[model samples]
Target: MLRWLIGGGREPQGLAEKSALQSIGEDQTQNPYTELLVLKAHHDIVRFLVQLDDFRFASAGDDGLVVVWNAQTGAKLLELSGHTQKITAIVPFPPMESSKENSQLILTASADRTVIVWDYDTGRQVQRSCFQSTVKCLTVLQRLDIWLSGGNDLGVWNRKLDLLCKTSHLSDTGISALVETPRNCVVAAVGKELIIFRVVAPTETLPRWDIVEVKRLLDHQDNILSLINVNDLNFVTGSHVGELIIWDILDWSVQAYELNFWNPSAQLDAQQEIKLCQKLNDISINHFTCDEENIFAAVGRGLYVYNLQMKRVIACQKMAHDSNVLHIAKLPNRQLISCSEDGSVCIWELREKRQLPAEPVPTGFFNMWGFGRVNKQASQPMKKQQEDTTPCFLEPVGDLIGHSSSVEMFLYFEDHGLVTCSADHLIILWKNGEQESGLRSLKLFQKLEENGDLYRAV
Candidate 1:
């Protein structure tokens, strides 16, 4: 003020510059992923989780048991046991529009090389069929009454497990992921490249179904770890190289946007910048889920939010999980649910951001020797400033903790709470909106493990 008054009034320019600098000094903080309830889900490693309906979800484990749970109350609804080996995939059959049947069917593929169809409500196996090789993944095409299974080879089958077409011509490498598009196209991730196929009509020469590879997407430099179809024309993929690629089904020529976990800035110190670069190189996107305009990514142990249209990370929560975050799901209320190899499921809510008052610089503009006048000037507002500038961090609003070993995967729905499967070979159903103090559910699990004949010698 004294300088402005003495030097022909430069207050406006000086204040504007100060305001700009202050804004630049503000640091944005993200919310931590919290836990709600932990259900001891499986007796063996939970390999797959699937939502059966708005109120129910099912989990498959290495113990060869498929259990269904009520999401709202964390109650076990039914246990479907049949598979002899690890369950690799589980998917709910799409409802038939023309039929009036009330019961829903679930298809489970296993390392035993068989696909079993079960009446989820009755807990009975309705049908079963063996594949030529161990089935690693399954995608149901309900409109045509056919489903695709991938393992040592890829095969198309009817609802009755009658093999329609089987082919190994697509790749010498095994398929890792499978997704079907609205345009009747199937995208198969074979090692590093994606093979797009369309079913050919059956004829006399081939009395069964046939598929022809339409296009091969080879944009990724490393193995494609996960694939998801955003819409009929758009899809997203995460690679082993920590790259997220978005592609258009209609036009492969449209360049894919490769996004990374972190973007460093010029102001960061050399050591800090190098550490960030190394972190991104070490991290790989493990799973992803989308809600409206944003995509939630589980990159290593962190959670990142990317704007779909802008193609950039808007927010991130580092070290969301102590171990690799294997799966992430977005809740209806805009919170996120994540499961990790750390054996926990967490819930995170993004709070509204507010501009906090900036802190006083430790050193003065004009310092005497190496010391400054900050200590003398900071006395009045030090406590307030310290409280305001206490780096905002996301803390999990609720925590679920019962899994004994690595939590392999989970499925969640707004109407249903959460169902997680683990290496412990138990499946837990977490109820939505219910609050209990300090993992009371663990006792329930202990009692069940002791009394239930499922784990004891017959």
Candidate 2:
């Protein structure tokens, strides 16, 4: 890899070191390789895995047991045992500030139709909460001392794991995933919809939940895969229809949309087949991430870069890894990191570019015109894609991959490596990127940050 970069006159940065890894825990699930990029023969498959926002790792498996590993060392810090059926999902809680010591705690969901809060450091069960149906997805809001869990039904609980509110069968289909936002933790279910509810402290009231309905979204035509909140007022979501929808949290209408290309195959199809991609229902939005400049989204076959303010598709690259995309996230320095079901983790540099005009007429002035213009946003569109054949910018500049299997989730450590979890039942520590890119996204964002257009546009 280094040789290829050097030959191209691109010096490798310190973060570009080829990855070498060691597995910490063995996966014990059956026929795990039935999945992509995962090495089943070498490890056991834990069904539900999470690298908590705070960097703690938790996973529950077929054994009806849950194990918590320190996100970096992959060391078995604690083991939770109780469920009689397969455990489906697990989430960790941040340490309470008032506690004298940092105690490790997590919420685990199971097929046995119950949810349990375990003290990972001591392997003690803080609370064992149950439901009528199997548990599928779980989310924790430590600051609010509340957690959300759902399966056939959706329920909210206090930090102690007591049922606070129940949206009995929010959808006919089972819940898929849950995420906490400023107002609530939005839950996506098997049906093409989402239920957003405010986190309420346990209290006696009319709704009694203190939790209120934010909205009920039925934007997708089929089952929704994942929901990523870009900000307090906006979110990006993917569905089984291969449609990626970006919406304002406060409004119900769709703001921007793109098709998840490459679901058909890897070979780039130049035959301009104008298909209606307004909705994407490919492999289900497996993972999603967005920085201040770009929204990085992936469903099995897609890697989409949607400009936040521009509201346009910038780069839609297809990575054929023979499996679904497990996770997509942003590094501290803002590079995009992605992992797939095929057992591969990739670091992506958000390359920015401007369209060159059809006529190569060079403008000799310093004024705003042509590619030489200060803002591509202000420049006229090229006559078409083919006539403007030259690449305005091209270079690889970020390095942020560090996983041996399908990295499911990650936690960032400033100035140090990040913590990640993989299907191989191993957690990894990765250094952030050090290389620089010649990509246009780099300088474009730089300009935006420098108030490059504020003085003139404003």
Mind giving the per-residue lDDT tens digits that candidate 1 earns over 1-458?
A: 00101122322222220111001111213322122333443456778778777877887778788878766556678888888988888888865677676668889988888899899988989899977677778898877767888886778877666778777745545788998875567888887888888876577897767877788887776788888876656778887766678777765443356444543233555335435565543467888888667777888888877777676666677779888888888875568888888777777875545776877666555565545656556455443321233233344655666555677777665444456776655554454322332245766667767898437744
Poorest stretch of ten by lDDT in candidate 2: 30-39
lDDT of 2 by residue, 173-264 (tens): 68787766655445454568777666556445554665566678776776777777787667777767566787766654688875524333
TM per prediction:
0.72, 0.66
Question: Runs in model 1 with CA error above 4 Å?
Answer: 1-42, 72-77, 100-103, 169-173, 201-208, 253-255, 262-282, 355-395, 432-458
Return the lDDT, model 1, position 360: 61
For model 1, give the 10-residue run with minimal summed lDDT: 17-26
Error of 2 at 174 (Å): 1.5
